[model samples]
Target: MSFKQPLKAGAVIATLDVGSSKIACFIAQMTDDEGGFEIVGVGHQASQGVKSGIIIDINLAESAIAHSVHAAEKMASRVIKGYPLRDVVLAVPATSSESHFVDAHVQMMRQNVTENDVRRALAKAQVKAQKEDREIVHTIPVDYVLDGHRGIQNPYGMSGQLMDIDIHMLDADFAHLKHISQCTEQNHLDIVSLCSSPYAAGLSTLVDDEIELGSIVIDMGAGVTSYAVFQSGRLLFAGGVPVGGQHITSDIAHGLTTSLADAERLKTLYGSALATISDEHEYIDVPMVGEQNARGEQHVTRALLINIIQARLEEIFEMVRQGLEDSGVEASICRRVVLTGGASLMPSIPELAQKILGKQVRCAQTLKVKGLPDATSGPAFAVSMGLISYYTQRPYEMPMEIASYGESKSFAERFKGWFKENW
Candidate 1:
């Protein structure tokens, strides 16, 4: 899909972040100040009928979407008159998608390059992206090559005999996208665009220097953990693991024989990924799954909880480490890592990530946007806020039909044919 349209000035923008554990909606408006985004409404509900980035029950998903959007719309209506929320930018989960790099070169007719020449190069890469069973989510430009220069940022006006482009393409399962689309459409909201969770987290959490100088964003949601690499202010890599905080909660629940709700509460209030000897001295309450009396509750050392949490977190970070190794980016550029998303809120997650990923890790919040509450200033709202911020930037790609059908395409490639049909 083409991200050619940008957020309009003084226009109201809505965002929906659908996840395994929670669904959140934000109704915001663009202000006169450049890059200003003021929130008019907000709503969130415990997500149902979605697991690991796939829709399991359309009715439940639609109901959840409706609840979140309507709550935000009601709040927004109180703030602005005559403007009803009708469209939203959705955050696509990276767990249900695949990210790959495509390189294509165009021989420049003239030594001086033009924008058309750059388009031609990207178009060649797009042709390789077509497949019937999958749909393109984001086609991001990673780096440009001028002749043999490997890291040229842009070759728009430069002189080069050959222009090579490295583009990052994210394709999601076509059926999965259709189900999500149906849920949102059922809620009377139009999905204007879809931004991957990793890109959204990076956009909302990373600073200017981190984006340009190179940084990795690890977004730990309830049901999925996604990581993105950014360099020169562009997305270089993105991938995800199905295991997330929810899995940790399940571990706590199963090991302690407690309810899922109680398990979540414990994880939220007292979970830690870095256990210490001192934790054994501290005690917390654990309620049994089916308890009627005080006898159902038991005392457990914090160390026990920490142990369970740490084990799952270690596994998560190990997977992230492996993903980064396979993501095609070099170790030198993976020096800085930023932790975001709701699951990243767990204590010592960054510490554990640093230890496991062997990179400098820090927790970050929503940056470069305005009018967010203190609660949303953390990493949890990174995706929703980034969905709102997506309008401030310009991204170019082909139309929504960036696919070639009626053939045996393996769930996934075709940008070259689009160029011929369009230009």
Candidate 2:
């Protein structure tokens, strides 16, 4: 394996995960040495600023962001009074995001892979990707193919007559980008870099072997079901459907004739993705909104509740299966699917996902971090924890070669800044 130099350490890095259910803030200190980062602080608040999967209420979302960040800063015992924590690694949901795999091959000027050649090949991919209405947010190298032999992660230091690249390029609608930037600017926070939420979660939850052997990480978040297909330690494809755990709650509420809050409470306490009639022992209780009996008691049967929850979960898994099929990376996903995110915590989700996708499924959690309490380090916190890994694993050096090749930095830089600063 080739070693890329690590980013500067000792600096405080914060990550913002704005999702349908909540906005989470994570702050960590990168160690100067090669050890992974330490979680110095964390914060989370119920999200009121988003709907389905996109940011719809800017002011509310901004307030949520500010509150979460402030809590994190306070917990870390640091006063972020200056600059308002200008730099952040912001996680963008796939709601308004687009991803396409693009390849570029460049004839080698010499028999060796120089940094210049790699830069030119990547730039070619980015230019080709940004040719139309969308702007490229990330151009990550999927793999490097030198001559006839493939499977090269880093072609530099290897001898090759030509350098070929497979890149996963992420883009967003121009309007979405502008709106996000304006929203952050209004709050005096600049985004440093924008990372796809699914991709980031995959980085932390997926093991090296899983990526090499081909695996799918499915993030069953509140407002969206996001997925990433990984192979050879790179993201091959990522997409998100509009359905998520929230939809399940809504389905239960509608199907059971219950209030939203009651639906949510039932989902958390009694939801099951794979329920059999035999599992029903007794009737469960679901309170009626603004209506109570003489003893203030209301109840529903467990089997009825499970039926509603299971139907919704099955639909979600089917949607995930369709998303994997749409990615068209490989058929290997049939054997490997890792379930994550808040919804995955449901007791029967793993078995249900396995049955639906015909894959071995398990809930994923962040590993190789210290001082993370168990309560906050499960699949539910996968995205927030994964952001820490993303910040630590990213190469520190600027893509100077891409700049020297006469590539315009205004759009990419501004977009990257928005990602880096807003977290």
Candidate 3:
């Protein structure tokens, strides 16, 4: 299931996001308008068996997925009863993700280029992207070269003897992906496509200008902080650090001698990535770890909590900076950075990220999608919304390796007039 069937009116799409802190599921159906969709159901459960995007306890992970999917199904039933939730698009973390630029050249068969020519070049690179242990997540075209001249956007109508394409290849760890597959298959759901969470986040968060001009998207999940780079209206790279919001909560638990639950509550209620002098005077109740509920309560300044949160977030941003430098993308391409996901909800996250990374930073949520409740429209559901958006994109084909199943048939039916004219 490398490429999904192109979306059309009445086609249903379901997505699952397995994160370190939570597991979420969304069900949506394509609208009559082209590239328009509306969310019909949403459900997210606290993650139980997954740690750092790896499944440790198979049973626990399966159970969590089951509950999440069930809730989403229940909600969707109101709109369309008996909607089958069998196939789904999966969102995986960007841990161990890799990116590359490969060139594919093809000599034109006819005087005027055709869409088939472009597909052939992309298919050629798709063949080259076939690896032994890595699973391809995205194969995107960045540029077009025609007749030895670069920067050709569309060479279809012009005369060109030879054409080449610059393709961006993205892949992820096979073992990590397999584990999630096994767990999902156990829940009776077939995996149709797997997308890196950061790439998915970029689709839902970046506006048209950001996607066209160039920008970076950072998704601060519970277990991993993943990033994606976009330039000239294409995805350039994706990578991640092993630290995220979960670590900050852990730090708070250790520093303040509180339970993980209470630490999470504190982080949600009063956490800040940037601490201020006023925080020293603000006091909050901290329940002791060993003592009983009422007797063990103690008053501590919010400054201590902010310090712990700020220190850990700084390290995360530092690692993200090092990652971008190692990615080999030019600093000029990433004019601004956008933050999303669960952790980006903290106060002053944009300020802290800007200070540490030395780039313009802002927090973002899922943009332009409809029917998502307030709970699922925020930064936390960026990846979930992204999977829905990914469903609407034109599916790239790797003809030599993977077969074109439903997508080919659907395309033919949808464009029968053009096919008849060309043939």
Better of 1 and 3 by lDDT: 3
Which lDDT tens digits does candidate 2 get at residues 274-315?
Answer: 777765775777766565663544566788888888888888
Using lDDT as the yardstick, the better of models 2 and 3 is 3
Summed backbone clashes in each candidate are 10, 20, 0
Alpha-carbon lDDT, every model: 0.78, 0.73, 0.80
- RMSD of candidates 1 onward, in order: 4.9, 3.2, 6.1
Provide TM-scores for the models: 0.89, 0.89, 0.89
The lowest-lDDT stretch of 10 consecutive residues in candidate 1 is 399-408
What tens-digit string does per-residue lDDT give for candidate 1 at 180-270?
7777766766666678888888887888899888899989988899988888877777889999989999999998999999999999998
Best by lDDT: 3
| Model 2 lDDT, full chain set | 0.73
What stretches of model 3 exceed 4 Å from their correct place?
A: 1-5, 293-295, 366-368, 397-423
